[model samples]
Target: MSGIDNLPPLREVIATHDLAAKKSLGQNFLLDLNLTAKIARLAGDLSQSDVLEIGPGPGGLTRGLLAEGARRVLAIEKDPRCVPALAEIADAYPGQLQIINGDALDVNPLEHLTSPIKIAANLPYNVGTELLVRWLTPPAWPPFWESLTLMFQREVAQRIVAQPGGKAYGRLALLAQWRTDPRIVMELPPEAFSPPPKVSSAVVHLSALPAPRYPANPATLNRVVAAAFNQRRKMLRSALKSLDPAIEDHLHAAGIKPTERAEQVHLEAFCALARSLDS
Candidate 1:
C-alpha cells in the first residue's frame, strides 16, 4: 500500500482511528478526498515543492499531497490520537512524509524546509490566525515558504483579501497585502467537514513577492497598522493620535488625507506613514 492506495478511504480511516473533531483543538477534518485534492491543487505545481501542512487530522490532506506528487510533505499534528494514522501515511510513503507531533505554533516550519516551500493545510480554527502571522513576519528577508494555501473561516479569508474600505479590511489585510498577494481560491460550506463548524470556510492562497510593495520597517508598520485599526471607526486624525500628537504632520507627509478613517487609507499610505514615523 502506498500513500495513495494503501490507506482506507478517509471516512473508514477516521472511523477506524476514532478520530472525531474536537472543538478545543479546532479540529475540523475534511474527509472528502476530492475536496482535499482540490485544495492541494490550488497551490499550483507542487511536484518540485516541499509542502508543509498544519493540523493534518487523520492524514486526509497528507494523503492528498503525497498522491499529488509533492517532493516532500511535512505535516504537524497536535492530536495524539491522529499520530498513528499520520504515521501510517509516513510509513506508506517512506522518505516522502515527515510527521511532527506537537502544536504547530511552537514548531518553526523554517527549520524543516530547505527552500521553495509551499504550505497547504486545513488549519485548525483556533491557531490558524496566529500561525499566519508568524509566517507573515519571519525574522528576516526572504521568508521560508514561497506560498501559503490554507483554510480559514470564510470571514477571515475575506479579511485577508479585503480592500482598504471594506469592513473586513484591518490589520490582517494590511499585513498580508504589504508583503504578499493574497486571494480566495475557493469556498467550502460548513457541511464539508465531519463535525461541521458553525461558520463556512474558504481557502486563501498567498504568494510572497520579491519584496514588500512599500519600503518601511516591518516592525514600525505593524505597530502603526495595529494602532490605527484598533479604532477603525475613528478618523486617522484621531485614531493615530498616539503615533504623533500632530497627526496632520504624519498624514501630510504620507500624502494621506487627514479626514480619512483607518480603513480608508491604502497600504502604500500605511507604509508611508510608518516611514514618516521612523524619521
Candidate 2:
C-alpha cells in the first residue's frame, strides 16, 4: 500500500478524524490504494486534464488522481467531516487538490476549472445515476467535461453499457451510448470498501463523442425511450401508444418493426424513432 504522501493509512485517518461512513449519504469509503490507482489509470492520462470528483469520502480516490499527476483535482464532498481529511491531502499536494464542501448536484463544477475536465469519483450510491444522467444530457454537443470515470453499483455499471437483447439495457444504456462510449473497466467485490456495501461495484469510463452517434431531438428521444421502456414487456406499437396517433407510422418510418419490444430495440433505432417523431 503505497501512500500518496506518507499521509498515514486511510484507516488511521478515518479513526483519528472520527469519520464513519454515513449511511444517509450513501457513503462507502474505498480504502485500497491499489484499487483506487487502478481506477485512476482507467480514466486515461490525467496529467493533462483537470479532474472533478464527487463524494471523496476519506480522500482515497482523490489521492489516486493527484498521485497519478492530474493537472489538478476538484473534489465536491457533501460530508462535512471529510473536509479536513481532504484538506490534509490538499496541503500535501500544494495547489493541486481543490475541495468544495458542498452538494455536487447543486454546485456547477464547470465554473471552477479552466482546462478540459475529466471526472473521477467513487460516487455515493444514492445520487450516482441521477448525476450521471445530468452529465450526459447537456443540450449542446461536446459537454463541459472530456470524460467521466465513475464508480457505481455493479448493476448500474452494466446498465450503462448494456446492449439490446440484454435485460440490463434500458434508459441508461440509451442515454450513455447515445453521446459517449461507456465501458466497465473494473469490478470490485463488496470487501473492497470500508464498511463494505451489500453488493459488488464496478468502475465505468465514458469518453465523450464530439456529437451524438446519431441525430435526433434530445427531448423527443428521451420521451420516446422512456415510454417504450416503461412498458418494456409490451410491443413497440402497444407500448408507444401514448406517443402519437401515428405510432406505427413513426416506427415504420424509422425502419423499426412495430412488433419489437423495448429491450430488443437498439440505440440507432431509437434515434430514428425520435427523428421520425419530429417529422
Candidate 3:
C-alpha cells in the first residue's frame, strides 16, 4: 500500500550499513519489508496507541509500525552496531520514532509512555519468553499495554496457545490463558531471515483481559503447574507431593481426579488446585 513509509527496503538498509546478524546477541534480521508491514497490520488498532518494540535488529518492522500510523514508537535495541542504521530511520520519520540503546528487560517501557501501548516485536529467541512473562505478570492490575504482538519459534508459539491434554500444554499455556486470549496470527519459514534459524517462527497476538479469569495466588499456581508438568507421567497425587502432604485431598475437593496427569488437567482445575493449596 502507498501508505507504507519511504524507508529503503530492509536489504538495502542492511547492505548499505553493513549490518549482519550477530548470533551472540540472538539477532536474526527480518529483511522483508512487505512481511514486516503485514506483521504491523496484524497487531490490531495502533492509530491511537504508542508502540513498543524490542530487538528491532535493522528497523524493518520498526519502519512498518511507523508506516501504519502508530502514535509513537519506543524501540529498544540491545545491539549498538545497528544504532546508526536505526538512527537513519529516525531521521526519516522525524519525531515519531525514539530509539533506546539498552537491554529491554532493564528498561521500563511504561515509564517512557503512558497507557494504550502495544508491544510488537520479532523478539530474540533467547529472551522472548522471559519478556512475555514479565509483561503478563506486571504488578499493576491492568497492564500498561493494550495488546502483545510478538514473534517466537513456532514451538514456543504452540506452547503459548496450547490447549489442555497436549504435549505443548504446561506452565506457559496456563499463565497465558490465565490472563489473555492468545492466538497464532502468522507463520514464517526459515528463509525469511538474513541467516535463517533452524526452526520456523510464528507471530502470536495476545489481548489482555480485564483481569485473570480464575482467582488464585500466582505463586502457588506457578509452583503447582511446574511440579505437576515436570513429572507429567506421575499421577497428580505423587506429582504434587512436593507441594503439600494433603495435595491429593485438595485435588479431590477441586473435582479433579487424583490419578490425572498434568496435561489432562484444565486451567480452571489448576486454579482450583492453587486455591486449595491456600486453604
Candidate 4:
C-alpha cells in the first residue's frame, strides 16, 4: 500500500490496470509516493486551495496532492486506461478528488475549480510548454490559479526562469517573468520516472503577482517578443523590422539598443518596447 493512503501502491495499480507508459501521449509515470508528496509540498499551503493537475498517470501525484491536504483536486488525464486507478484514489479521498478523462488543452478547468486555486502537475512532455504558455497568457491579470507548481524538462524550466543575456532567455522567459514570480524549486534525474526520460526534469513554482511587473499591452508584448525571438540571432533592428517602419526609433525610445539581440533585452525593456510600439 502507498503510505499516503490505504490504496494499492502505484506499481500494483499499474500492473492490475495494465497501464504501461505510452510514448505518443508523453507518459512517464512517477511511481514514488514520497517523491510525489515532496513535489506537492512545493505548491505550498494546499489546505485551502483547489489544485488542477494535468496528466496524472496512475494517480501518483494526485494521491500526493490529496494526502498533502489539498482542499480539492481536479485531475485531467488523456488516457482512459488510468481512470480506474484514479477512481480508486477518489474512493480513498471521498469528496476531495475529481477526475476528467480528456485533453487538458481542450478542457476548461475553471469550470471545475474554485477560487484560490493552485495548479500542480507532472505534465506530459509533449504538451507541457503549450499549457504553460496558455496559463501565462490568459486574457486578464491575476489568473485563475494562485500559483503553479509544475514539472518540466530541466531545459524548459531554465527557459521559464531564465534571465537576460543567456541562451535560455527568450519569449518564455519574458512571458513568465512579466507577471509572475517564477523559480525552479526542485530537480529530478531521468531515473525518477518508471520509463525514464532521456533528459532531467525540474519543478517550477510560479506565484502570480497582483499585477504585471510592468505595464504593456499583452497582445503587443506577445507580438513583439515573438517577432524578436523568432529571429533571435538577428539584431533587434533587423529582427523587428517587420513590426514597424520606425522599429529602431521604438527600440531607442524604449531605452534599448537597436543592435541588441532578443536575449540581450530584459523584461522591463521588452515591456517598454511594446508600449513604444503601441503608442
Candidate that would win on TM-score: 4
What are the runs in model 2 whose C-alpha is more than 4 Å off?
none
How do all the candidates rank in terms of lDDT, highest first? 4, 2, 3, 1
Candidate 3 lDDT by residue in tens digits, 64-133: 9988888899999999878898998899888988999999989988778856889999999999999999
| Residues forming the 10-long window of minimal summed lDDT in candidate 2 | 1-10
Q: List TM-score per model, in order.
A: 0.96, 0.98, 0.97, 0.98
Better of 1 and 4 by lDDT: 4
Which lDDT value does model 1 have at 217? 99
**lDDT by candidate, in order shown:** 0.89, 0.93, 0.90, 0.95
Candidate 1 lands at a TM-score of: 0.96
Per-residue lDDT over 1-279 for candidate 2, one digit per residue giving the tens place of the 0 to 100 score: 355556878898899899999999999999988788889889999988999999998898988888899999999999999999999999989989899999998999878886789999999999999999999998787999999999999999999999899899999999999999999999999999889999999999999999999999999999999999999999999999999989999999988999999999989999999998998
Better of 1 and 2 by lDDT: 2
Clashing pairs in 1: none
Candidate 4 residue pairs that clash: none
